[model samples]
Target: MNPQSADAGDRTTGRYKQKREAILNAAARLFDENGIKGTMLSEVAQQVGLSTNSITYYFKKKEDLVFECLMHTTSTISAIAAESAAGATPEERVTRFVTGRWKKLAEAAEGQYPAMMSFRDVGELDASYTKTIFSAYGDMFRRVRGLLAQGPVTSDNRMSLTIRTHLLLTSTQWTRTWLSNFSVTDYGRLAAYMCDVLINGLLAPGKPWAPTALDEKVAAIKLPEPSNRNFIAAAISLLNEVGYNGASIDRISARLSVTKGSFYHHIPSKDDLFAECVSRTLAVVEGMQAAAIAGEGSGGDKLAALARSLVGFHFSPRGPLLRMTAWTELSNLEQFYGQVQPMRQLTQTVVDFLATGMMDGSVRPTHQAIAAWMVVGAINGSATLDKWVPGSEKTDAVELYLKPFFCGICSE
Candidate 1:
């Protein structure tokens, strides 16, 4: 071929790749905002100023596009982890790994690639494709876990490694939601603070730490007793399994092995039932907060107690309800705002506690708001702990899970 012809072909290939990336980036944003089930191909095209046919030209199916987007994210994260492999020490490697990813995510936020990617619909893809995607994720997880193991703070125990890695990774993952609402001007500062908190914890050095005593009174402050608990428990399970719209009263009743009339007898309406679930979740959370604050330990101790209590609840029978409610679509339901007030209150409670710790020099002098957000996000993300590490003992699980955020690897 002539030199001119070859050059023209190269330029065309470059344009195609650029356009394809644009589509994927737009699709990621839409998927994050509306969820995969809620987004349409046409919407993605509209965002990219292209046609649905053009999108199909690049990605033959919606599933293909979604899979590629997720792969792109996991691959990018893996690359970030690999980049830090040359660090001289485990602490340096872990810090660089997290900080680098945060900077990349912050930069990506300014363009088509949203800071966060969703794999919520990965199970809906082809078996082979799902395996490939999960393999990529596993690689990333292993790399981080390996780095943590190399560090001085991590343990030889498999459970400890698994819990710490999950907490660190998921805390970062949840930052996507945070970045969406807030504008970040300095990625370096943000990354440094996050790394510091996770690595060194919010606790000040030399502060006394003690486990909060768990007694019958504290344990009883959970969800309603068994008689009326079935309704909320079943609803939470269904919600986690099938989301908000799919978790209808009838399905919940079927799951509970009760008649529709019996369901109505226990709960007034689906919305009402959801509100009650939300209320119960808040109640349990508040109960933990109250207990933690009322304790005679330092503020850092209170935070640790709160983290342990929340994680323990995740392993309980009512854990699914708490987890599901945290991620539920309450905005679509009527009169749900009233129920959501407690969530805001919970945030305030966290903020106040962190501030108290800071004031008392029990916690580090960092951004209390962001630290609080990370704490709450970690707790909510623990909903998958059982699936992540099956048969993990409750006490051991809580200790390992909260270790990274509270004591950190360096401190330990």
Candidate 2:
């Protein structure tokens, strides 16, 4: 071939590679912001200045692009977990993992890396794509769990490791939700603070985790609006299983063995449906908090009661509490319901509990807000108890699940 022809071919290849990375970057960001079910490939194409048809040159279909994007995200996290494995101690490993991950997040915030993903819709993909995604996630889960393994591999430690691994992962992931509140420079400090909460826990020494029963019991939740409570429950079930977009009108109606007309009759729109699900979640959380606060107990009592009740509620008929990933759609839900930021209120309520505990000598003097985020993260992750653990029915969530966060994950 002539030199000029070869040189032109090389230039074309380089440009193609650049655009492909650009597409992946843009798609990842869109997926994170709008969710996998919510983002359109054409939107990704538009973000990268390519025509939708032009995108097909790189990815023949939207799922191809989504699979690649998810794979790219999985690889990024696996690499971090691998590196974090080098720490000599479990706490050090935990600290390094959180710090390194956030540094990448700092970079992502500064456009240095693809936006870190929320694995909420890993199940939303088709069987062919999800098999690979779930496998990658499983490996990553093991790697993080390895960070917590101290010695002999007993079922007890296995339980703790499994529980703590999810706790650590979800809490760190939850950081992306609230961490934006801080500057990129503050991420490292915040990561350290998070590690402290995970390792040392929130309980002040000598303060037993004696969560008293609620003074005034919360009535079973009837949501969206009172008149359409059953319909809202079905909708919440679908939202928890699928997602906002995946919870189609068809599925909601079918879950209740009703017609689409019924869904529309009971629920006005999908946006309203999401608002109702979120509203129900906040109501449950706030109900527990209010009951806890009204009782005469240390901060520890209020928090323990709140955490245990919320987690157990998932197993209850009204359960599953709107999944933490639902918070990503906060802005849209807020618009639908007007300016009541239920998520912010949720975090602040935990902060109030932690602060109260610290004052009353029931909880340690830690970074109250960050510690609250850990609680939020751990509890959010634990809500998947039925799915993640075998015989989640038999599992004492307060002991096996909640203990890691309430008492230190590493404590004896």
Candidate 3:
């Protein structure tokens, strides 16, 4: 081999590699800023100071290049998740895990992938492109699930912990992706706070499980109580599928396959029914928390049980009522505060746990107001994200994401 020819060949290879990287970066920025369908190969090539023909030489199809760009972004996120996992303490790992992904989203917000929010939203429409993105976050998902399933280091497990973990991650990320109406700082802070609540609940003292109690009560009493009180269950379905204003007595009656007269017997009027639905849903949540508080367990166990109950119940079919409650609380500010005190009380239990934990040495010093709101937001985000992710097997996708944030704020 001639030494001069070898050096020239090496230089040629290096230049080609650099150009390819440049093209991929440009494509990602474009995709994150514009929808994948909105971006063009010519635009990508032009952005990178390359001719269309030159880009074609590297990537035959525009989509092939788009897929690569998505993959590149995913890879960056994967590296961050890995780094977070490798960090010294759970708290440091969580902060890095969260902040690192936030930085990635901020960077991409100016591009095409960010525009789409997440690959799962459009993966079915373009499988190859989404696959590349999914590959990047798969590891993070596994790590998150593993953490939640093990029973928190500070809490107890009352439900399917693995399922809850998956729900938490799915919902939190989806919220950040879809609800851009909220600021990024608020979303991130909210996610971190919710995770802390779950962690505190798991490790705190008490029997935090709910389904078990329902089972025991049913067994002992032998009474067939309504899984839901009266027509409240049917009313919730209508409210979720349609907005609160759209759901009327006629609609509820129709959904129940009963006459309006039959529905009237359950409640006084449409207004009463809507209020009842919200109250009943909150009652279930509060009931779970109450059970956790009263049960025999450590503080950590009580907290985890309450956390699991909150997340699990929220994902249940009736869970949409929680959103309805929030909407009502915000929209009818005059009436919501008075009518929704019981629901807010469930939230107070969470706030109380954090305040109690901080003072007792279970949780680090943190503001109850800030921490409580963060958990609430993350739970909301988790619900929003699950709707957009494609082929997501998770029913309770927010659990894992919430757990780490929960763990991050704990004493240990």
Summarize candidate 3's per-residue lDDT along 131-246 as a digit string, tens digits: 54565556555565443333343324423443344444543444442345456556566556544544443333432233344333212222123544547766665554434544
Clashes of each: 1, 0, 53
lDDT of 2 at 283: 78
User: Which pairs of residues collide in model 1?
Assistant: 202-364
Q: Sort all candidates by lDDT, best to worst.
A: 2, 1, 3
Q: Which scores greater on lDDT, model 1 or model 3?
A: 1
TM-score of each: 0.84, 0.86, 0.45
lDDT of 1 by residue, 68-124 (tens): 788888888888788877787767877888888877776677773444475544554
Best by TM-score: 2
- lDDT against the true structure, each candidate: 0.70, 0.74, 0.52
Q: Give the 10-residue window scoring lowest on summed lDDT in candidate 1.
A: 1-10
* Model 2 root-mean-square deviation: 4.7
Off by over 4 Å in 3: 1-230, 246-250, 260-268, 286-297, 310-326, 329-333, 358-370, 374-412
The candidate with the higher TM-score, 1 or 3, is 1
lDDT of 2 at 343: 56
Question: Who wins the lDDT comparison?
Answer: 2
Per-candidate RMSD, Å: 5.1, 4.7, 11.9
